[model samples]
Target: MAEGVGRGEILLRPLPCRAPPPDGAPVTGTLRLLLGDQLTRSITALDGLDPANDVVVMAEVQAEASYVRHHKQKIAFLFSAMRHFAAALEAEGVRVDYVRHDAPGNPGSLDGVVAAAVARHGPAHLVMTEPGEWRVRQMMEEWRETLPVPVHIRPDTRFVASHDDFADWARGRRQFRMEFFYREMRRKTGLLMADDAPAGGQWNFDAENRKRLPEGERLPDRRRFPPDAVTREVIALVERSFPDHFGTLEGFGWGVTREDALAALDDFIAYGLPRFGDYQDAMKAGADFLFHGLISPYLNAGLLTPLEVCRRAEAAWAEGHAPLNAVEGFIRQIIGWREFVRGLYWHEMPDYAATNHFDAHRPLPAFYWTGETDMACLAAVVDVTRRTAYAHHIQRLMVTGNFALLAGIAPREIEEWYLAVYADAYEWVELPNVHGM
Candidate 1:
């Protein structure tokens, strides 16, 4: 996808095509619950899965999409991705009981949906990857009330940092900042490292990466994924379900499968990475992407792994296709800042969400929703966000996010706004970026 997620060609795929298990497969295995973000099959929760006896439950209930009044594009992207993942599992001989948003008498919550699945399948137990959001995890904690079986929540291994590992790194530190943490991550992953040293003898080159897009420099044509049958259907459903949502449902181009995500990565490295380090922090009036990789959504989703993305950048540097600054900066975000944020998020929560170090108290202005502000930069960023559900990091941090903080808007309100609008926002990732900042 473009920065946020930019252009890509839509590779349409229907639900799984493989035949189901034997006509009378025994219902002996525990039911596996899959959330919208946990779309990969490599999840620990699915290890040793039994296609003959176990059932996989994936749902698109109204409760989630409506929980924050998410952008119509975000809702459509997740639902469409979930459907494709479920279908892929069914093709692999796993029995998947997918509940649609429009399913009759849908209970609207994960607990409610899982309980319904239990009644239909009569599984002995439930297995799930730990959810990303604290609020959702709180609900999972009380599942015994709704489910007849015991529930087991496994750690999500998609991230390089586990809860314990992150806590260990942060323990007994008097003053915490990302630079030291990032250095340790570079050592831990061996990314852009040589013989126990950073490849460039520097931890970060961000200071040198502040150049603006030069005048008359043209941007690469963005990769746009035209919606196919499945995506078109999802777009229509989102339009009907979220008529009042903030952003437009038209021009939806996010990649919903593993192949599409890989294609997105290739496109970025080919055209974006060379210039990314030079102008990463620069902003143009109407350019939403510039040289940034819009692969964060794919990375956050199970479609692509963070470590792998970093390795790709490292490889680009090693092969001399990209400068060390460019490669190191990109890798640092994936392995360093991203991991640090998630670690801080888990270590500091269920109190993190309530953090307001500045004690700010104000409302997010109406301009955020309408992109009608007088500031040229802000209005342009908001206009792009309204159309694409994305704005580059500068637009987010220096424009809208900065305005909210300077105006003393409540953290919770702004957090909700970010969560509602970005296609890549999940509480685990979005809350830390918002509240911790």
Candidate 2:
């Protein structure tokens, strides 16, 4: 564990510090753009990049921060994580050009920043992994034509399937259920696969994983991290700048670095994973995170990869620390529902954004904003979301999302609500869950 720092006792094992990259070195290679979500070193944008010659650009732009009414805690977590990632890259002798959102005379857009970087460094080309949203991809297309250097948009290789691979898988299928897709992913990753068969003789344990919380059952101790110096600075900024946002910044304990994320994963494996499936669908009045690994924020932010998380769960099963039902269910979520939703979003987007098969056209009820409904379940989950910017999948789907769909709420309105409220809300994942499934 690292030092116990900031508001509360958060024992975070900090990544080893290295000397920062010096300036005025001759720039001879590509200038790669790293989005806030794309913080990993293994991303294709930095492939074959020379730390001495190449430059990496990361920014906190106002346009993205204010694109929607994001929870104040959500903004603080992402901004702090991005800052830490840039510092980590710079310490590894790579030149990082980090632009702050409040920088003097800074342009409020990513393309504008890229244009300035090109003028300053004069790189051979610009490289980036494919962006998470269709909107950003369109922006990149315009940049390719106008920028001084050739722009390369590489495939984001973090997933088991590429866009082309998913397109191929989806071509002739009339009905796109997640089970068939998940089986293929299982085969591809060889996760829980025992040669020609699945481990423990089943492909899915979903039926076995749906037990509710019994009368007085217990949940293991949840690991919480206190905001470090970088995080504290971000929290202060968010509190000052966006005080009226949807959520509070009081319990801001997400792990912003890879080491902290791994520690969270370890905590889940030891405490949460064993009982995860048993209570995967459980929802008591006051219980917020019951046996669920609340690591989606880190997973979405690129600090923790989906594959790695799934692998850890499978390892727990193999070592007999957790049962097969729990491990399989957890793995299925990462390789199954998560990947399927992303593929569906990308495959059907631009048009997918317009999906309203049910023709539900009611405005979101006032209770969604204030959690003031007479319904105890609805009010409880919304209160949790308001305070922590988190609710388990069941609360999101069954309680909140179900209410929206049943009342015939406008799809876009609810879409933005899910996007703005959750810590793990991103278009690639959130849209399909809201509009399609």
**TM-scores, in order shown?**
0.92, 0.92
**lDDT tens per residue, model 1, 1-437:** 11011101221122222233354663246678888888788987787688876777777877778877788888888787777777788789987777777766567676677766777666666888987777778788889666667778889999887989888888999966888989888888888888898887888999879997899998987776788787888888889888998899778888888788889999999899988999999998767799989888777778889888888888898899999989988988888878888888888889888889899989888988897778998799888888888778888888888888888999999998988888887777778888756
- List ranges where model 2 is wrong by over 4 Å: 1-28
What number of backbone clashes does candidate 1 have, counting pairs of residues 3 or more apart or in separate chains? Answer: 12
Tell me the number of clashing residue pairs for each predicted model. 12, 2
Worst 10 residues of 1 by lDDT: 1-10
The alpha-carbon deviation from the true structure for residue 338 of candidate 1, after best TM-score superposition, in angstroms, is 1.0
Q: Give the range where candidate 2 is weakest over 10 consecutive residues by summed lDDT.
A: 1-10
So what's the TM-score on candidate 1?
A: 0.92
Per-residue lDDT of candidate 2, residues 1-437 (tens digit): 00001110111122222233356543246778888888788988888778867778777776777778888878888888888887888789977777776666457677777787677667777888888888888888899889867788998888878888799999999999899999999999999999979999999998888786788897687898899999998898778777778888998888889899999999999999999988898787778898999899888888899899999998999999999999999998999999999888889989999979999899988788799999899899889998888888999999989988888999999998888888888889888998765
- After superposition on all CA atoms, what RMSD does each candidate show versus the true structure? 5.9, 6.7
6, model 1: CA deviation in Å?
26
Candidate 2, 214: how far from true, in Å?
A: 1.5
